[model samples]
Target chain A: MYRVKVYVTLKPSLLDAQGKVVKGAAVNLGYDEVENVRIGKFIELSINENTKDVNTAVEELCSKLLANTVIENYKYEIEKE
Target chain B: MYRVKVYVTLKPSLLDAQGKVVKGAAVNLGYDEVENVRIGKFIELSINENTKDVNTAVEELCSKLLANTVIENYKYEIEKE
Candidate 1:
């Protein structure tokens, strides 16, 4: 069996309103040391396949359907057990 | 200073092509136990300010910029040292 970990995040140019809101809340709660908030995503997957040709197959999947190349970025690690 | 962590993921219904590719690769690589791959994002931010009054402000910010309620999901944690 194999496990894959993926991460996606917004481009630095885009504004992060949610991070700001949480910052505001922290300050209000007397946790005024907080400054900025940027949010992103994390995903983990388990694949059932032979380890021989998984790399190329995985890359194809990433380009075709896994991530939206325009707005988000993605990276992944593969582990075999 | 405070740190915020955010995670975003696809709403299950959407296709995860990246995951499929990874699975295929694993199978070919002779690691046939791999099954699926789901991709997501992770974000970390630090705020430098008085710890008071940050909560409300943070929530407002989240609603305005951080996450897209229509598509993504988010959560956060605060740490003080």
Candidate 2:
């Protein structure tokens, strides 16, 4: 099996309200060092061994269903098991 | 600067509603090959250089602020920038 680890984050130009909320909470929780606490999405995919050309498969998946390319940016790592 | 990439995921015992929703959408979008789409949180922390022992710092931050240990499991990567 191949493990696909995907990290999806909003574009820098976009505002991250969720991250800001967490940052405020962190400050209340006494973690002053915390800054720019951006929250995004992480997805894990266990690609079937039969899938051909795993690289192409992941790229297609990311663009089509996994990520909304207009507002979010994504990059991934492929691991062999 | 230290780039700390943190991944927070729900434990196997927890229900992942967001993942289920995405999987259902994928099925409707004609991507039946997709299975077990687990969604989690991806956070990037730009650590200041003054922070000593980056490993310990990330561990503490992950437990205290980045993840909820009760239901989620977290891991991280630390890189120099």
All candidates: TM-score: 0.53, 0.85
Cα lDDT of model 2 by residue, B1-81, tens digit:
788789899998998999888778766876566666789999987767777677887798789878889999998998887
lDDT of 2 at A75: 96
Instruction: List ranges where model 2 is wrong by over 4 Å.
Output: none
Q: What is the lDDT of residue A39 in candidate 2?
A: 81
A1-81, model 1: which lDDT tens digit per residue? 766666666667877787567667656766555565566657676756555666665565555545567776767787777
Q: What is the interface RMSD of each candidate, in Å?
A: 5.3, 1.8
Judge candidate 2 against the unseen true structure and give its global Cα lDDT, from 0 to 1.
0.83
Q: What clash pairs does model 2 have?
A: none
- Number of backbone collisions per candidate: 83, 0
How far does residue A20 in candidate 1 sit from its true spot (Å)? 2.9
Residue B52, model 1, lDDT: 63
